[model samples]
Target: MAEDLSAEIGPDRSLLLVDDDEAFVKRLAKAMEKRGFLPETAESVAAGKAIAQSRPPAYAVVDLRLEDGNGLDVVEALRERRPDCRIVVLTGYGAIATAVAAVKIGATDYLSKPADANEVTNALLSRGELLPEPPENPMSADRVRWEHIQRVYEMCDRNVSETARRLNMHRRTLQRILAKRSPK
Candidate 1:
């Protein structure tokens, strides 16, 4: 991890990290502090929006979904309060449409979930002149689909019928997919 990212830290080192996963956000906040940020954490969309509105941060890492609502709501509030805020939207349920929506709503970048502190930092510091290098081993299409289905299944409380209905998939087909191990 690169130290002394003070150059990238805006007028203030204030950073907001919002995610529903308490452990993950806590760990990421500590990692960011070591990299020279003053991170404030929030575990829900309402809390995140309140923090962003009360005091817009110089940089933000927001989750795409929260217990209360979407993380994009917080992103929008921050952008409205501070036009120059560098915001990154993180999502466990990664999809091209959501990525585009995040960017369209003023997010600086969109990252899939399980992103490391370094990856988030790089995203915050990116100038957009150069494209990021492609992943050494990107997920295969089948793997991506499987991941999506699994995420939806979890989101639907592991109710196969609800998950299948939400995914527009037949219940039996969804069951078959759920029964198998994840593709690499």
Candidate 2:
């Protein structure tokens, strides 16, 4: 009789971590390993897709952006490859439009960037549409405005001048806003 290699971890504890940020991937992978998950990582959608084809993960944590393409591509592929895979989309550029699109494509949940590993594990394991409670102290209006400006700046491909123009704010003012630390 052949011994099952998967016995070391629970059968469904395998995971895929897809993100272009190497540091984030490393940290999350280690944390997931400590949580009994065997996490395999890929920095691009193509690589993630190949990994899924060879061995579908039981859970996945994907970044919204990647070096090669959007992470939604990977989420869709994972869903197609294995309907049971639970997926969470993480983005530093969180916005309602993309979050809705991600869920529509089969992600289990959507989370903003800087989320810790514990939060991710909870998200992956939790069932149904219920989400963790929101942070007691949410972002201030100024912080929200800053984040929205930053999101637009990023979408404009980091064209600061263009972002300032789009936001109908002066260039120097935009720079000042970008330079300041986010409010608590």
Candidate 3:
């Protein structure tokens, strides 16, 4: 699908992938390259910004948080350099506020982490006029709860008490949940 779209956009097909997760970035890069893109990888906001400034890509997938800085900064740089760039903001800790901010700042779409290559490709190539198909197998309620708790825990600097307070959950309960493996 992306091959057809890439063909229309000429041979450039340059894609910038910025994520602090080295393994995820490497995997995505290889997958995207197979789908007719020329990929460039970066592991920090600073490196991403540098690449965006020097050579803006036609397509980009940037993580929401990075070790050096916010990925929004990289998105801003890309938007400034390439007005028509198709950018997707990927985050593990998805929130309405951050999603809204990403769209307001020129992100084409916001995807939660663990999105497969096919999902990412579709998001990149799909026209805004059409609605995306619903996920065939949405996460179960238990999984969703687990994800939310994990996100809150990470936000609280892994302090169980702080996270429990923020979530209105008991600290011991939070600890038990944290100790358990995430649900499928």
What TM-score would each prediction reach against the true structure?
0.75, 0.70, 0.71
Candidate 1 structure quality by residue, lDDT tens digits, 1-184: 5487887676699999999999999999999999999999999999998998899899999998889987989988998999999999998767655676789889999998779999999999888999878879989999889868766765675588999999998999998876665566
Lowest summed-lDDT stretch of 10 residues in model 2? 1-10
RMSD of each: 5.0, 6.0, 5.0
Q: In lDDT terms, which candidate is top?
A: 1
lDDT of 1: 0.87
- Residue 91 CA displacement from its true place in model 3, Å: 0.7
Off by over 4 Å in 3: 1-5, 133-184
How do all the candidates rank in terms of lDDT, highest first? 1, 3, 2
What is the Cα root-mean-square deviation between model 1 and the actual structure? 5.0
Please, what are the lDDT tens digits per residue for candidate 3 over residues 1-184? 3344566445679999999999999999988988888899999999999999999999999998888878999999999999999999998767555677789899999998889888888788767888767869978898788777777776675578999999998999988886665566
Clashes of 3: 0
Question: What lDDT tens digits, residue by residue, belong to model 2 across residues 1-184?
Answer: 2223344435778899999999999999888887778899999999999988889999999998888978988998899999999999998767655677789889999988899987888788778667456889977887778668867876686677999999999999998876665555
Pairs of residues clashing in candidate 3: none
Model 2 scores a C-alpha lDDT of: 0.83
Over 4 Å off, model 1: 134-184
Best by TM-score: 1
Cα lDDT of candidate 3 equals 0.86
